[model samples]
Target: MAANMFVVRQTKGTVLCCKCGILMAPNPANMCVTCLRSEVDITEGLRKHATIMHCPECDSYLQPPRTWLKAQLESKELLTYCVKRLETDLIKVRLVNAEFIWTEPHSKRIKVKLKVQKEVLNGAILEQSYVVEYVLQDHMCESCTRFQANPDQWVASVQLRQRVSHRRTFFYLEQLILKHDAAVHAIKIKQMDQGIDFFFANKSHASKFVEFLDKVAPTKRRESKQLVSHDPKNNSYNYKYTFSVEISPICREDLIVCLLELLLVWGISDRL
Candidate 1:
């Protein structure tokens, strides 16, 4: 026979509520859940409504002090975005749970379900559920403002011409441009009789675009530059270039490549 031993269990002592006189665990208030909820509210002073800056052109929201971020609906990114906006409002309380509440279709409004916990009555913690609403206000983003503010800021251009008298081939070019997103760097795009014109603020971008067209279709390229300004003191010359691209039915290396370039002045410097 083997020797056997018995052990005693240690448990925390329980107490009774002062108001309702019911058995409960120890707490700062020594009260029940129902009584504490009825007495104090942790959702006090929480904002019920707020306005958010939204850019309709870009589908992005402003995060104050000149920061723009993208957040899709019903996502954690949006939840964090909402919480960040409420940092000042939540100074007194702490967030326990935050989530997006579905809004009416096509309303462009957002509602967030919130749960906050706060310590009160000297160490007693209380959690409460509430909701906050966000009203979207239309605000144009900086990039959109730049294009709208200065339509004539393009510095270089590529004029694409294809000598086709009949059926649409430039239409095919449009599809190709859309597929490759090659026009993202262009400041402006205009449709012409022979073909299309792509405008850019940077001459290098024009060269890149001409390269793209050459790769996608049988084409020849030419480059030309005209003197714009001469700084005699600095011994520098500024020249504007124009690029003319001819789209051919067949590749011919003998055809001369043409380029046209123009210059426009702007305040911001292009880091690229």
Candidate 2:
């Protein structure tokens, strides 16, 4: 009677790992942790050596196939660019962490350490880390390349000039341009003795810049167009536009001073 009163309990079953023959819970690959990690390559198709296209002239990097992006040394943007380059292969697993392994700036090599995880077995996650070295390859960005090809080639130009003894007016104008992002379409911004030159590939962009200057600064605007070429068949004419912006020569703290002797000779100051 006592022997018939006992409750029956079932123990969990186990299986042997294919390679190591270690007894473990049932899993998809039928392999232990050590063997599965060694066998499975979560970082497959990821290149150990990568190339990042950089513009030596502008100190910018080529983002993917076409876009040019400016990124500071060891900045988050640079790190994001590195990670995006590995996006195709990294889709296979989840990225845990990625950080830069600092190297000399002059070395032109960026090292990124990546931690990735993959779940190959039943409820078992495998994590691994590896470093990828990115070599900066000299590739001129589109703007710089175009500029080098033809420095004078532009459809529109903005000649920004301030006729003042100091550069404070130009400095303020620069801040306004940055605030409004007025020069987004500018091909190149050049510092000139007179002031700054903003070149563009489109006439509309130059006109926009002139409008921006009108709103921000007290300036006079002049426009001129030069005929570049003509398509007789299409009856289309190509012209290059130029917008001359001259900021006022007046200063906030300036005073108009006349000497008493000079005023006496003119007999104007003493008339009041």
Best prediction by TM-score: 2
lDDT tens digits by residue: candidate 1, 164-218: 6743557777788877867766766888887788887789989888888888887
Name the regions of candidate 2 deviating beyond 4 angstroms.
Answer: 1-45, 70-77, 120-122, 126-129, 175-184, 249-272
Consecutive 10-residue window with the lowest summed lDDT within model 2: 251-260
For model 2 the local lDDT of residue 122 reads 65
39-149 in candidate 2: lDDT tens per residue? 887777777899889988767888866888877788888899899999987888899999999899999899999999988656567788989999999989877788889
**Using alpha carbons, what is the TM-score of model 2?**
0.66
**Which window of ten consecutive residues has the lowest lDDT sum in model 1?**
255-264
Local error of candidate 1 at residue 6 (angstroms): 2.6
> What TM-score fits each model?
0.57, 0.66
Q: How many clashing pairs per prediction, in order?
A: 13, 0
Error of 1 at 270 (Å): 59
Cα distance off (Å), candidate 2, residue 84: 1.5
Return the lDDT, model 1, position 210: 86
